[model samples]
Target: MNDCVAWSGGRPVEWLLTNAPVDKHWCTIHATHMTAEEATALAASGAVVGLCPTTEANLGDGLFPFEDYAGAEGNWGVGTDSHVSVSPIAELRLLEYGQRIARQERNIAAGTQDRSTGRALLEHAWAGGSQASGRSTGGLEVGQRADILSLNENHPVLVGRTGDEILDSWIFSGENTPVQNVMVGGKWVIRDGHHEREEEILDNYATVLRRLST
Candidate 1:
């Protein structure tokens, strides 16, 4: 009880599950290092399991019980903790592979009819990411956030792919900067593989990091 209370920031998961503010969206972090019971409890509370794949693998964090979570129809998403890597595909593949290595089972993460583990991984991460971030994104289905990544189809890493294969290649293969463009908040943030404010953004970040170090 104490752990659950403390884990939930003094409020019980039941409270969050029932009385979550309609206006102020909420998401839980560091949902790793939990028991199966705790994981199930969190799923029941409508919290998205925030998976940080690269950091987890780097730090040797054990595999998350994604199978159990998915069995419960739990919401989940990904993050770039430590920023050591930044690609949705790597995140997804690492997540699934972690499960596979643990269970020594294939297709344990498919979750439902007609769902490939790869596709499920991508959909869950992207959609749950937007939900966790209090935004509406993840696809081109209309009326969602304009934040989008345009892949370089001609890139060798992405050549000879379509559908889930494109996503699979993107996640598994070391395809970098093949992202030709990105838009955020209905504006072009990256034009021709460069941030519109690249120089300024980099300058500000450098300034902040240097100041913090001293």
Candidate 2:
């Protein structure tokens, strides 16, 4: 489960395809070297692929075949591996941008007619991430945890945006975080764009960094 940077070439994919326990085990195949056939097979096997675009690019990993992965109807989600980037928005932005650059096309991640690239990416990632974590999350449902985010409507990138366009603007155009509030399990952990324990958390984090540097 959640194998970091599991490159998808050579024998790794084959082994995973043949040996991975069904419905109980999933791999986070980095997929930089993944082939189309391998992707299709992984889709058929119902394995989850973890695409960490920020870390992959920082480490010079090859571009993932995102279009092919989507075409095969593969299960996938974004990750922020290695602490290089922490925001889910940035991870998503880079994921779509990488695909656009490689294919020289706009909205490569849309994958279907009338689908918003941002919304599609968000839903896929949320679903796959929920499955990976074995949680009843990823959507607002009757039994799921009450995890929610409130975007800042007044943010410059969000002006005049609505529906899926809001997600698109936040992912592709916003320079700063647009999440104004966050709640988990019916409790507000973040409000007015500030974490509830920000000051104390930063103080402890700085102490640890100082100790490590010494």
Candidate 3:
């Protein structure tokens, strides 16, 4: 906010939108200060607003205008900005929870009675994330990147849950990760709840941490 106010000369949303590229994203969930006109234009412009709820809460950045942004039919997605929380569940959960708290309402993400809250949030994030990345990885279909997340069907919390219920259980149920496998481009990167190169990755991360700390 301070930076936007200082740098944008009181027209932060317009300045940022004007300067941002059309083919990419306009990030940092700029709706907090956006007017109705700016919100509508941003929605129509088709730039995905990267809303990092966990990071925003961690830094006390302020509440995003969920009603305004979604009301304008905005394209939006979650992110792990500053690495506060890498779990997509955490991001989506907090996004909805934050809105619920702010608006004193429930199921704000679904935006309707018939829609499942978790399902709605997941679809919004999935499509917007793919679009913002400019990648052909949005859905499970031909001509799309084979990006997949397979949940542990045997996980206690997930046992017997089906369809959107599975997503609801995973995202809203507990902290323990239920993802058993992950595949990208038809290759397995995570299986049985472990990354293929976990040890090596941790070792390299420690080395980088030491170097950066020094």
Model 3, C-alpha of 55: deviation from truth (Å): 0.9
118 in model 3: Cα distance from truth in Å?
Answer: 0.8
Clashes (backbone N, CA, C under 3 Å), per candidate, total: 1, 0, 0
Estimate the overall C-alpha local distance difference test score of candidate 2: 0.79
- Residue range 89-163, candidate 1, lDDT tens digits: 777778877887888877556755465666767788877898798888988878888888898899887898988
Off by over 4 Å in 2: 1-10, 22-24
Candidate ordering by lDDT (highest first): 3, 2, 1
lDDT of 3 by residue, 1-214 (tens): 5687787765666776678765345454535567777777778787788888888788787777778879988888887766647888998998898899988888898998777999999999988888877788868889899999888889998999888888888988868989999998889999999999999999999999999999
* lDDT for each candidate structure: 0.73, 0.79, 0.82
TM-score of candidate 1 against the unseen true structure: 0.77
Candidate that would win on TM-score: 2
Off by over 4 Å in 1: 1-25, 111-115, 175-177, 203-214
Cα deviation of 176, candidate 1, in Å: 2.8
How accurate locally is residue 47 in candidate 1, as Cα lDDT from 0 to 100? 64
Question: Any idea what lDDT model 3 has?
Answer: 0.82
